[model samples]
Target: MSNDNDIRHGRHCVFLMHVHLVFVTKYRREVFTKEILDDLRPMLASVCRDFEAELVEFDGEDDHVHLLVNYPPKVSVSNLVNSLKGVSSRMIRKKNYPSIRKKLWGGALWSPSYFAGSCGGAPIAVIRQYIEQQQTPH
Candidate 1:
């Protein structure tokens, strides 16, 4: 069971959904610097806000970024990913970091593919055991 505070109450439903998302740079280019990642954090948060979600955590390496987002059930992961990639890409490119632009010949910032995993809550084994112990109705 989740803590009561952790659960979110919507107008007609309750949910607590989190996704760990990983986005790699186009062609796996190493373009992000500390300054770039700093700038990116707020951009991602803003995008999440637009979707009525919260960006709980964010970090990145030169080649990729990881985001932990808490979202409502109404928001689809695909749509959120699209907005995150699109908005951040445009914003980053607009800054015109010569090193980044040079490395990425194409205008695209992220690869077409991404990794998203549902996170938080009990481990699968625990859930399985609990289900197995349940009493069946006659």
Candidate 2:
């Protein structure tokens, strides 16, 4: 009935948006490990589904992670980053991963700030194809 409502309930179309999400470890500490990364995937995917987005790919070094996601038109990039930050921090801390909890400095696994951006107009399918091509053969 209102413009705000219209914007909020817009159609869910495949817009092929590319968002770069950077999540820093709490206190800028190096906490990530392969064991922890294995556990984080499903949790992030569930949140993405709720936001009408898809986590296309994800990777991390010790201190931060980069996520490539396809977000729908109605989702706010800020809100999406918050969910990823807040939820991952809470979940990882609860798991008692020592490196994470120790450097977290207050039972937090991630920093509050994150990075997000548009795709810079690159075609999504083409990008995905290129990424796929770079993978090593099993």
Candidate 3:
């Protein structure tokens, strides 16, 4: 249901790639507070901006965060995730929140693994039907 305007333009291609990402805290500790989540929003947004991507949506519970990012094809998902985790962890640790520090004894804010899924487009069945309807060249 997206319009042409929803597509992004690049020097060599047009794209509309979005990924839903989830990052959990190390050991799934319930360390996040409202104030901490508020601070994290801008930090994550800044990291997205660095890769020429947009963080379309972001939210989290006490132990994890979710981000919907619209990124260009040139950027790899793993790389983006790494930067997001690294920067946010370093910055948050720098803040020295007593509650978070005490819970995260291992020194890493996020767990080593994360979830990434492609989103924001027509269903695969619809696309498949469209492809099947294409006329063949004689």
Best by TM-score: 3
lDDT (Cα, tens digit) per residue for candidate 3, span 35-137: 9999999999999999998888899999999999999999999999999999999999999998798998866999999999998789999999999999989
Q: Which residue pairs of candidate 2 clash?
A: none
Q: lDDT of model 1 at residue 108?
A: 94
Residue 49 local lDDT, model 3:
97
42-100 in candidate 1: lDDT tens per residue?
Answer: 99999999998999889999999999999999999999999999999999999999868
Worst 10 residues of 3 by lDDT: 1-10
Question: What are the per-residue Cα lDDT tens digits for candidate 2 across 28-136?
Answer: 7888898898788888988898997778788888888889887777889988988987887788778898776566676567777788777635578988998888969
Better of 1 and 3 by TM-score: 3
Relative to the true structure, how large is the alpha-carbon lDDT of every model?
0.93, 0.76, 0.93
Model 1 has a clash total of 0
The order of the candidates by TM-score, greatest first, is: 3, 1, 2
Model 3 stretches astray by more than 4 angstroms = 1-5
Candidate RMSDs in Å, in order, are 2.6, 11.9, 2.4
